[model samples]
Target: MQPAMRSLSPLTPSDYHAHGVCCCGTPLLQHFHERMMALFAGLHGPETVSASPRGQDSPLLLTNLRLFDGSGAPLRDNVAVRVMEGRIQAILPGDAEPEGAEMIDCGGRVLMPGLIDAHWHTTLAAITQAAAMTADVGYVHLVAAREAERTLMRGVTSVRDVGGPAFALKRAIDEGIVAGPRIFPAGAMISQTSGHGDFRMRHEVPRGATTPLTEQERQGVAAIADGEAEVLRRTREQLMLGASQVKLMAGGGVASTYDPLDSTQFTERELRAGVQAADDWGTYVMVHVYTPRGIQRALRAGVRSIEHGQLADEESVRMMAGEGAWWSLQPFLQDEDSNLYPDAARRESQRQVAEGTVRAYEMAQRFNVNTAWGTDILFNPQNTPNQLRHLAKLTRFYDPLTALAMATGRNGELLSLSGPRNPYPGTLGRIEPGALADLLVVDGDPSQNLDFLADPARHMRLIMKSGRIHKDRL
Candidate 1:
C-alpha cells in the first residue's frame, strides 16, 4: 500500500476559482456572444472555429436512397439531400435529384447519424507485434494514430476522449495531421499523490515490471493535487489546456496497482473544488469512480458526471438521481479471451472492470438516472481481437434504438451542444429540416436490426459527415 502524503498548499473554499459559485451559470449563458468574443482567443484559435465556412456547397447529392434520418424511424427511399457550407440545405422526396447535382443511387440502404463513442481513450495505442509486453512512453503516440484509424473505420464520426496523458494526440488529430473522428478530449486526469492515477513506486515493485503508473507517466497524466488550492488550480489548468471537460480520480481504479477498490482518495473539499473550477470555465467535471463509498462522496460534492461506475450499488444510483448527476455508463461488452495477459492480477482487474461496468449500467437504468453512451475500450485490438465484439455486449440491456439514442442524441445533449453551442435547435441526431448533415449509409436497416453495426467495414456502405463524403461507393 502507498502511504498517503499530506498536501502542503492548503486553501479555503472562498478563495477558490475567483471565489466560488461559478460566474458562468446557466442564466449567464445568454451573454454567449460577448463571452465567446472574450474567450475566443482561448477556446480554440483566434478565429471562431466551426465545422465549415459559409456558402461552400456539397459537390454532389444522393437520390433514390433509403434513409433513416438518425431518429430510429422507418426507412424512406428515393429521397435527395443537398449540402452547402457543410450544413444540410435541402431534402427532396420522391427520388428527385437536385438539378445539376451529381447523384448516386443508394440501392435501399439505411442512413443514420454518424455514431459517437462517448468515452473512448484517444491516446492509447496498439503495441507492435514484436514488443507485446513493452511499457514505454513512446507507445503513447503510436497507439493514438492506430486507434484513431480503427475508430474512423468503425464509422464513428465523433468521440469524447475521457482521459489521456497531455492530450497531445487529440490536438494532432483535430488539426488534421492525423485521420480520425472529431475529438472532444480531456487532458491529463486530476489525481492525488497516492490517489488513483498516481503511479509512484509502491513499496518497490517486483523486478521486470515497474509501478503501474510511473512518475514519468505522472508527467503526462496523474495530476497529483492535494488540498482545495492545488486541486482547483489543476482542474482549471486542464480547462485552459483545451480540455472539453475535466476528469478527476475520485476512487481506486483497475489501472492502479496500489489502491484498493474500496479506498476513497479525494476528499469532499477537493471534489467540490474540481467541480467549481469546471463550472467557472463553461464546462463540467467527470470523476473516475467505482465503489459506492467513493462514488457517494463524489455525489455529495456535486460533480457533473461519473465515469466507470463499477462497484456502484443501488444507493449510489439513487444518489445520482437526487443530485441530478449524469452518468457515463459504459456497459462493457465482454470478451472471452481477454484473460490472456500473463499477469494474473492485471487480467483479473480487467475482467472486474468489465463486470463492474455492466453492473453499474444495470443499476443506473433501474434508478432512472439520465445515462449516456460510453465505450471505454482500452485493450489493444491485436491483443484482444474481439475489441469491437466486446462492445456489442453492452447493448444487451437496451433495445437497439434506445442504445443508439444513448450514443447519439443524449451524448450531444450532455455536451451542451444542440441549442446554444450549435446554430440550430433540435438539430443533431435527426434529419429534419435544418438538422445536421451527419449521416451513415449502412448495408441494412439498423433500426430493425443492430448486428450490422458490429462490423462497419462490411456494413457501412457510406459515411457522410457535414455532407462531405469521407467514405462512399460513389
Candidate 2:
C-alpha cells in the first residue's frame, strides 16, 4: 500500500562532495576531514574515511580575559564568560574548565561591552549633501550597508538612528540578511515648516505649492508638519511604521539652510502633540535642539531625550537634570577637521556649537544629569569611519573609563527610554549573566591607552554580537 516504502539511498562520497555537506548535515568546513577524504576518493582509489565525532550544540566559552563590565567598576583579571542562545549564561573563573563547550582563549586581552552610538543617521551614507541628493535610492542603501558593516567591524555593536529611512535596514539586520550592528530606528524626523530637518533647496517652493515633495521627503527621510494636528499625524505615521522613538526638530541646526541657530522651530503645543503621540505608543520623543528656549519648550512638552545641548546654559542643564531627562551630546570641537560647513552662516553656527561643548559638559557634570555620547557624523562618509575616535574625544571632559561608560552603559539607559518599543529587549552595555552578548576583545587596556581604539582593525582582536562571532583575529 505504501509502494515499497521508497527506500532511501545512503549518501555516497560523490553525493557528499556535490552537496558540500558532511556528517550530520553540517557545512563541509565544520567537518573538513570528511570532505577532504570524499574529494580524494572521488579522484583516487576507494579509500573510505570515517566521520569524526560531532560535538554537541553547546555554549561558547571565552576564557583568560580581563573584564570591564561597563558599570564604572575596576577591571577584573582572569575572567571567563559563557554565552548561550545569544545571551550571557555565566561568568566563571578563568581556570575553571567547562565541559562540552566551544572554547576561545582570549590570550589575556581586555574584554568589554561593545560601543553604542546614541545618535546616528543611516541614510546619509554619502560623503556630501550634493551626492546624497543626487544618488539613487538603491545605491544609497548599498552604501549604507557597507558603512554599517564597517561600523560593526570597528567595535560598535549597536546604534540608534535618530533620523533616516532605517526601518528596512534594521529589519534586514535582524533577519540575518545583512551583517551590521543592531539598530534602533527612528523613522522620518518630524519637522515644522522651515525647521532643521527641512531640506528644501533655496529656490524651491514650499510643500503643497507648485512643487512636489523633495526626494528626501518622499523617501521618508524627513517629514514636514505645520500645526499640532499635522505634527500628531506625522508622529503617529512614524510610530505605525515601526519607529522605536520619535525625532522632532525643536530648534535650528547647522546643516539646514532656512532656520537660524538661535531661533526655536516648533511651538510648545506642536512639540507636545508629537510627545503625546509617542507616549500613546509607549515610547518617547527625542528632539534636535540646542538653545535654552528650545530645550525648555521640549522639556515642558515631555520630551525624554535632548540632543545637542551644546548651546544650553547652566539653567537649562539643571532643568534637564531636574526633569530627569537625557542629554545626548556630541563632542564637537573647533579643531576637528570634520566639522567644516559649506557656507558662512553654517560655519558660524558650527563654531558656536563647537565652542559651547566644554561648558555643556561642565554644566551637565555640575547638575549630575544623565548624559550620553554619539558621533552625529553626518554628510561625511569619510568621517563615519572615525566613530570610535569621536568617542575617544570625550576624554577631554571625562576620564577614559568614564567616556567608555558613557558610550556604553549610559547610552543604553537612554535607548531604553523607548520602554516597550525597544526592539532588542535585554540588558545591553554590560557583561553579566543576563545581558545580551555584545562584546569586544582588544589587544590592550583601552583605559590606559585610548589611542588603542583609534585603530580597531589592529587593536581589536575579537568582535562578538548576539553570541555570533563576526571578527576573530585570534
Candidate 2 clashing pairs, residues 3+ apart or interchain = none
RMSD to the true structure for each prediction, in A, is: 15.6, 9.5
**Compared with the true structure, what per-residue lDDT tens digits does model 2 show for residues 1-474?**
111111123434554354444456656564675555443322222221112111112477888899988876778987798888788888898876766567777888888998899999976743467777888887677677767767888889999999999888788678654557899999998898889888887777645655677788888989989999999999999999999999999998877777898889889999999999999999999999999999999999999999997999888888999999999998888665456766888888888988898899988888999999998888787788677888878888888888888888888888888899999999889999989989888987766747788888788887888877666666
Q: How far does residue 383 in candidate 2 sit from its true spot (Å)?
A: 0.7
Instruction: Please provide the root mean square deviation of candidate 2 (C-alpha atoms, Å).
Output: 9.5
- Flag regions of model 1 displaced more than 4 Å: 1-56, 73-79, 125-139, 165-167, 203-219, 337-358, 379-390, 417-428
What is the lDDT for 66 in model 1?
70
Kindly give the number of clashing pairs for every candidate: 5, 0
| lDDT score of residue 62 within candidate 2 | 83
